[model samples]
Target: MKIAFYGSSLVSSYWNGAATYYRGILHALARRGYDITFYEPDAFDRQQHRDIDAPDWCRSVVYPATEEGLRGVLAEAGGADIVVKANGVGVFDRELLEGVVARARPGALRLFWDVDAAATLDEMRADALHPVLAALPDLEMVLTYGGGPPVVGAYEGFGAAACVPVYNALDPATHHPVPADDRFACDLAFLGNRLPDREARVEEFFLRPAASLSDRRFLIGGNGWETKAMPANVRHRGHVYTAEHNAFNASPLAVLNVARDSMAHVGFSPATRVFEAAGAAACLITDAWEGIEQFLKPDDEVLVARDGQDVADHLAALTPERAKAIGEAALRRVLAEHTYELRGAQVDALFKAAMAERRVAA
Candidate 1:
């Protein structure tokens, strides 16, 4: 039951959007009598950005996280029953990854939990460090937060013993619907950090709608959005953290999701915002992607928009009551099947299977 959950600074929720997802799943596992030791590189004080810290559910070990420091820390993981090395740990290089593999105790589970599967696989395919994934047979498991079926296929194709898609799910305790506030609410708002790929999509899908409905209000939030010569009606609020995110969503009529380059291209990567928006009972309008309908019912729980005209149409067509109904339905779906607790249970099941196989081998 002793698990070494090694990854980024879950201590901070500021820039690290994955914090709640980690916390929800790990905390749920802890309640099941699993003893978790969360190892994080003591980087920026994530506590400064968020209102909380590692809950009493697990023990957190903050290491100095230099190359040498990681060597020392990886050595500490030897005693645990499972050691999970998630991508985007924010303190990784070949040395840390290789050292963990070399130093990992045989019989103890090792997981390359790729939170960003689409991007990570791309990195593995292109880089000299590609052997990192090919060495999966030596590890116990491979888990992904998104990429659903495509992720599982790729890992097994590469000769992995096991690959599981542990897609992102809701952490209902922290993400529930908030009361819609008129002052903060808008007919449609898009909240995402500005990225080159997303910027183009935003212009095509979000900005155009805002411009089309000049009489209506539109709000944009997230970091790296300064370059956009946004319309005056499109208010840009830079980098709203977890605390502010719910209010931001509550203030909007429907929140738009523009996937980043890696995710949009991959077709299965839904951002944390998807669940958050749904959980908050805020209507969601997302760009068309092949795999989206699997998670949400288009024109029902979610509105699929491929262009600015589509977005404008959704805005003009839907009433508040209907939008509320969609948000509620999406929330029900998330709560039923998409929570982080469920994702963690999925991880535990894989561990159980791996351990069972090990026993059979013995």
Candidate 2:
């Protein structure tokens, strides 16, 4: 089957946190004999800061961030078995959606893959007349990265034919225990891009913890965090690349996973960082979220914290052996159930079922 996916940059993690997730799922699908053509706009400075070129697994096409570019992308996507307009494409998302839906082949399945379902749903609920919200009913299916039943129900409420979550998973090949590097070595580390939706939580979960535990070493990795007045104990490393993730996770005594406001509010949304850190065998401490236990058991496979004090307590109580055991257990759980290969299979099945239903309807 041939799939056309239009999303954020496939070649850069500069401002794109979904890069790893995209690579994992697409690479797995390609390995399973599915052909994929990824379309990404040349805006967002991603092209200037690409970490990867076109991988042999799939064709990566970069187009201009203009009207002509949209036409070209639409033309290229015309005949695919499936066409996906992923969330956070960083340019003219509504326009892209309108065009993809209009120009898509009659038999082709159109899907809206919401990497940020929490934010998307919140916006959709707030703005009933939003073009994208109005367009939801026209799409074949809506997929999300997080939010369990509640998210699905909400999308269905918005007139979607169907909605489901394709949760983030570990790409074991890329994330695993590696020899620790001195540069990233710290008592606790949190890696994420600085975004308005998540900055407050970062302050509560990461910054406050750092302030309380001034003696313990802390590291913050990702872009756009340099301007924040972080505690002295917390060191900010701007934009840690995907290539450095394993070492970055391994070196940290216990990594932190702080969910964005929308994700935390809606629940069941585990960020890619959660799986990546767990896959690396890094003991992880995350803020309390409703469906966290579905992914990682509290205090057994992972540590759950409700506030800065909880994080501080976790850091203080973390012994080398305890950390090792927690990391091992989480890794075991992730390997057993959460892998991109598994997600790829799930996606393939969803596509097949949709096609089968379409055939029966015809």
Candidate 3:
């Protein structure tokens, strides 16, 4: 099978949260004998500041951020077995979705994969006439990162023929335990691009905790955070690149996962950081979110916190042996059931089932 995916930069995680998802899933699909081509706009300086070299498994195209560029890519995607327009593509997504669904081969599966389903659904609900809702009936299927049952039901309610939640998972080859590095060593570490939806949660879950734990070291990674005033005990390091993830994860005594307000409310949504931290065998701490227990057993495989006090308490109570045991358990859980290979196979099965049903309907 040949697949065409349009998304945020596949080569750079710079300000692109979906980069890991794209890279891991596409690489896995390619390994499963599916030919893959990725199309990303050259906007956001992502191409110039790429963090990873081009993968050998797929063709990566950096196109002009214009209408002509969109048309050209859509044309190239004509005969693909699957054509995907993912959310957060950093372009006019409604326009891209329309073009791809309209131009893709009749037998091809035209999918709108929403890596940020919560935000997308919120927009759709805010306006009944949103372009995505208008276009939903035409697409073959819809997929999401972590929206779970609520997200899938919302998309289906919006007139989608089929909607599925394809959660994020770890790539053992890219994100596994590694030797710790001194630079990232800290009592707690948090990594995420600063965005409005997540800023408040970061303040509540990360910054506040740092303030309370003045004796402990807190390291913050990702862009747009350097300007913010933080506790004296906290260190803000701008834009930790993908290549440095293992070291960053290993360096921290315990890693933190703070979900954006949208994702937190939706529940069952685990961000890439959650799996990345687990893959590194870092004692994991996350703010409370529903459906978290389904992924990792709370208080056993992972620690859950509802506020700054909860986080501070977890940090204060953690001992070396207990932390190590928790990290090991989380790593085992992810490696066994939450790897990219498993996710890729699930997506392939969904595509096959959707296509087969389409055939029978025809």
Candidate 4:
């Protein structure tokens, strides 16, 4: 199968939150003998943030960021068995839709893989960035990277023939724990860039905890966090790279996982970090989210924090042995169910189902 992915910044992991997520699915798909090509628009500053060289697993093609990007889309899209338009690419989605309608082969699988389902739909409804979402029924199928119930419910209500959630997953071989370095070692750490809507969530989930745990060390990593006055206990580091993620996870006494607007609104949705932190055997303390228990066993596989007190209590109570056990349990659960291999298998099943349905119609 020649699968073409058109969305987001695939070649760069610097500011891409979905880096691990994409790598997991694509690498697993590659292992299954599927030929994969990821298409990302070449935005300004893309050169500066180029982190990973194209690997053997999949080919990376950077198209122009403007209307000219359609040329790259048109050129590489040929001979693809499946062409995926991923959510949150922030450009030329409508043009890609037009290109698919005008140019794709009748048998070519055109899929919309929405990482942000509710947010994407909401924006479309509001005439926000992704107004092209309403044209779903004309596409082959829709797949969500997160959002379990709400996403499916909403997409179907909007008249989609097929939609499914493929949740963010882990790749154990790459993310297991390692010895920690002093620079990354801290009592508690949170990693996420600052976004407008998520700003309040950060304040509520992280900053308040930092204030409560003034005696302990807190580290914040990711971009767009500058120009904010944080408590002295909080250490603000700019974006951490993909290579340093495992060490960062290993060194933390406990890692904090905060979901964005859509993930939090939809229950049981797991972000890429949840898998990454667990795969690295880090005791994860995440903010109280709906449907969390459906994915992870609370207080065993992971710890849940609702407010500042919850965060403080979890950090203060983390014994080395206990934390290790929690991390181990989380890792085991992820390996069993949430690995990239499982995700790829799910996609295979879904893709075959769609193909068979199409065949029957013909």
What lDDT score belongs to each candidate, Candidate 1 first? 0.78, 0.91, 0.90, 0.81
In candidate 1, what are the lDDT values of residues 145-223, reduced to their tens digit? 7786777787787777777777667788788877766656777877776766577888889888888888988888776
List residue ranges in candidate 2 displaced over 4 A: none
Error of 1 at 92 (Å): 2.4
TM-score of each: 0.92, 0.98, 0.98, 0.95
lDDT tens string, model 3, 1-362? 89999888899999898888888888888988999999998898888779888899999988899999988888887879999989888787778888887888888888899999999999999998887888787798888898888998889888888888888999989898999999999999999999999999999889998998889999999999988999999999898898899889887889999999999999999999999989989899999999997789999999999998899999999998999999999999999999999999998899889889879988
Clash totals, every prediction: 7, 1, 0, 1
Candidate 4 local lDDT, residue 46: 55
Query: Residues 155-208, candidate 4, lDDT per residue (tens digit)?
Result: 887777778999888888778889988989888888888877678888887888
How close to the true structure is residue 177 of candidate 4, measured as C-alpha lDDT? 82
Candidate 2 residue pairs that clash: 222-239
lDDT of 2: 0.91
Taking all chains together, the TM-score of candidate 1 against the true structure is 0.92
